[model samples]
Target chain A: MKPVTEAELHTYIDGALSEGARAEVEAWLVAHPEDAERLRAYAEQNALLRSLYNPVLDEPVPAALLAVRSHAWRRYFAAAAIFALGIGLGWLVRGMFITPQMLPASLPRLAATAHAVYSPEVRHPVEVTANEEEHLVGWLSKRLGTTLKAPKLAPLGYELVGGRLLSGPQGPVAQFMYQDARGQRLTLYVSRQRGEPRDTAFRFSQEDRVSVFYWVDGNFGYALSGEIKREQLLNVAGVVYKQLNP
Target chain B: MDRRLIIEHIPRLRRYARALVGDRYVADDLVQDTLERAWNKFYLWRPGSDLRAWLFTIMHNVFVNQARRRRYEIEQAMEEVPAVSVRATQSEQLELQDVDRVLRSLSPEQREVVLLVAVEQLTYEEVSGALDIPIGTVMSRLSRARERMRQLLGGQTVMPLKVVK
Candidate 1:
């Protein structure tokens, strides 16, 4: 027999009232058609609210708005690139940093490919020249922080033409070269403190037409790259790991 | 997983942020900062969770934190901030024209509950979590907001008081 309060009426309209409360409101509304008009206004507002915002879902998502697969990968790369640049710039400016490996992972791969391209020369091979192999090895050793050996490649059919000291995130890296009798060449890309092992196996990656086999262990990292088969590449990795780790 | 995936949600997040913050530039900045912070802290993101909600939660928190730090700035400019205009198609209905004004007239707390419940169509529980309020409080706020809207809209109401068997 009691009239429904405004609060109860609102809840009752929204279907939030308890079952008993709902039934009570229903019985009261039947006796009071005037209250029905009040309910209609709230319902109209709710309807209009839904109508106003619901179209947002139906709006066509602009192509530019999509998080494309490539975009995700680019973000991944950009993060890496920024991290690398930050570390590099920090080292360049302050010279005080946490660890050498804080240098970006991608930079070594670039260095490795560059090593592969320039290591072989009957004519013009190394920039610093290989006649000072010991100086090259010694200088890079002090910078990279482990003993350096230009790994031999006779089993893979190449001769140690020698090596060059190059700058890396860790400071200086050694690029050791070996050439076959027919003039085919392979480079043993060694960094004293290359990095913590990435996935801990020989990963053969190609940038352009050049193939690179890069691996890392507790002490150092090595990349032996050339135009080679997967098995041949892994075989190169095996030889480099043996000469470096052994 | 990727910053780009999070970027894809930027415009929607921006729109939502604009609605919530009532400033276009601030909303866009909130979205941009949300994206940047989300990118930095992404390693903490779980694989299976809802990224949109995650982004929204981050944006919501960032807005709250910024508001706290800049409370003086907010208070000084509070009265000067322009009122928001809701975009709705014009119709012959008397309610449509004033609905936007009526909705805006509600207190911010009440307006949030009404918009999230009625416009966003979120469940009471979800709105409670999103707004960080108790479910009971959510219901009360929602009921209060609806009642206020009803009063403003010429006291006309249409939702049924029917019992479901």
Candidate 2:
């Protein structure tokens, strides 16, 4: 064995070296008596440092030092919830502003106003007679640039009382009225815009208790307005959507 | 590792913290800080893993970083004072205080390695993780620190002078 380096001496004291290294260092040190004494002194110092600090672990931890549950977790969860809500709201607003899918909400208000204005008719109800239904249909078709067919109201026990030319938010509207024997009335408002594509389902939106069933098909939009039961409105809307879309 | 389980280990953490930092108040504060960090980032911990080691790692890092910052701040503040040269004073008794003085005399890195290995009794693997050092580095650091501690203690005691005619 060769002379032990200072590193090997330290490793020997700390018991970190392999057995081969230990044996080599040990044999080398046995030949060097003075280095052996120094090694013994180094070992004692290591032991003494250990003994001095080891008692700290046994000492009672002060009550103040313990890790207790904190209230900050609530704040963290609240912050996460707020972040999610903000993202959701931003998406909803963006969808509403940028797409026609959200146009239903605004339709009910317009429908309610249109119904209030036209339902009080006494004498002049329709612009043309049902006897001149063909001429009236042809005129409206030319003016609206789309086919205008009145919806059948057979299921509701009402005849086509009359229909008149009216104006609504989108453009010129065709208001078709229906009446039962009890004289309860309902109105269907129709309009057209080349850019607003046809929607194919009966979508009811309500404002001030008036239900508006509005739909689009190809280049025309139809809105039926009435103060009616939800089921009755849906039934009328069903007929309107089926006739236009079909 | 949820904090409720980690919080349950607070007694042991406090004990370890006290052992690491000599001052009881500083130890307690370190433990509290460690707990606060763990609780705030509790979701960051995976469900099944070593919670105790994870917590100790946090605690050890917080202590080291804080110690380094405090040292730097003190050094900056003390720069204006008249620099007094420190000379070792002979003490009458060989008490734990003497051992503490010897330990403090070692380089901070050496003291950390020595304490983690000897006092805390953490394995080389745990010490590596806690200190953010490689396992091999931990082994070498512990070996060197042990040697340095031995030399400091040897110098403190009065004995027959070695290699002096």
Candidate 3:
């Protein structure tokens, strides 16, 4: 039998050793009375530590800690509002000099707002489940007058949860929801709008904890929204863009 | 990063902070600062990584910075006032106060290792990652901490160290 080191003894006390190593340590401790006594003291110390601090877990989290989320949300919305105001001012100023076709559409902002409202839902997150993928695609395609395909995001650890039909300014919008193993949801919003067939570059925007990456491919506008980091959402956006465009 | 995902770790963060600082208000402040910093730098956090360990690392760094600042304040205050030894009461019973005193008797490094292992039940790997120390250092510090704790709690008077802020 390999001799148990002091670290192994500590690991035994922590209950982190493998079963075989734990058995070996226990056997060694039984043979050594002094080591057994020391282990007892360590166990008692662990109990005391838990007794002293574990109650903090049971205590209601102070309001200040809970306020962190709300504070972040407030900051996000404030920034988003400022950004929207800037865009609105820019459009107004630009409208004076250019035609309506030159003004960018507000579909991205709409998609972001829809994502913020619906992604956090515990229930009724989508109108149809992914199990009905064929029917869902057919229905959404007919409603939006485009061949709408739910992007396969399994490679990214996100599976299609479902989708819903939302009303857009131009026509119907199809929102396909995907969720990862961690229950984080991302929404892909697609709608056919009056735009020339030109591959527009991906534009990014954030609104109240939700990030959106939107672009136009021909007449269809697509936006991917999630509460993930920008780089991660961009990766997912790239995957969606390839699937839809290919 | 999702705010909700970060929010879910609040209770554990508070518990760890309280164990580190040994004061409710100070610990709460540390937790708040940690959360705020985490929010601001959420972009730096990698997805699909160990979020809890990452949060703990942030908390550890914040606590160390605050401790340094508070130590400076204490040094300035000590020059103005006589040095008073705040010794733990000689109580052998395993009461909560006795446990707290014994824990406070340890140096910050030892205390952190001990609390993270014994109280937070973090694995040695996790503690190493949280404290940014080598795993061997965590084990050695933890061993020393346990020995010191035994000596102190057994009614042996260890030398009074500087005040833990």
What are the clash counts of all predictions, listed in order? 10, 4, 0
Per-residue lDDT of model 2, residues A169-224, tens digit only: 56677777877777777787777644546333345566676767665555666678
* lDDT, candidate 1, B90-131, per-residue tens: 343544656755665666567667766666556666777777
1 versus 2: better TM-score goes to: 2
Clashing residue pairs in candidate 2 are A198-A216, A198-A217, A198-A218, A199-A216
Q: Point out the higher-scoring one by lDDT: 1 or 2.
A: 2
Using DockQ, give the best candidate's number. Answer: 3
| lDDT: worst 10-residue window of model 3 chain A | A94-103
Q: What's the TM-score of chain B for every model shown?
A: 0.66, 0.71, 0.79
Q: What is the lDDT of residue B38 in candidate 1?
A: 77
TM-score-superior candidate, 1 or 3: 3
Residue A25 of model 1 has an lDDT of 83
- Chain A TM-score values for every predicted structure, listed in order: 0.49, 0.54, 0.59
DockQ of 1: 0.16
Would you give me the overall lDDT of model 2? 0.63
CAPRI tier of model 3: acceptable
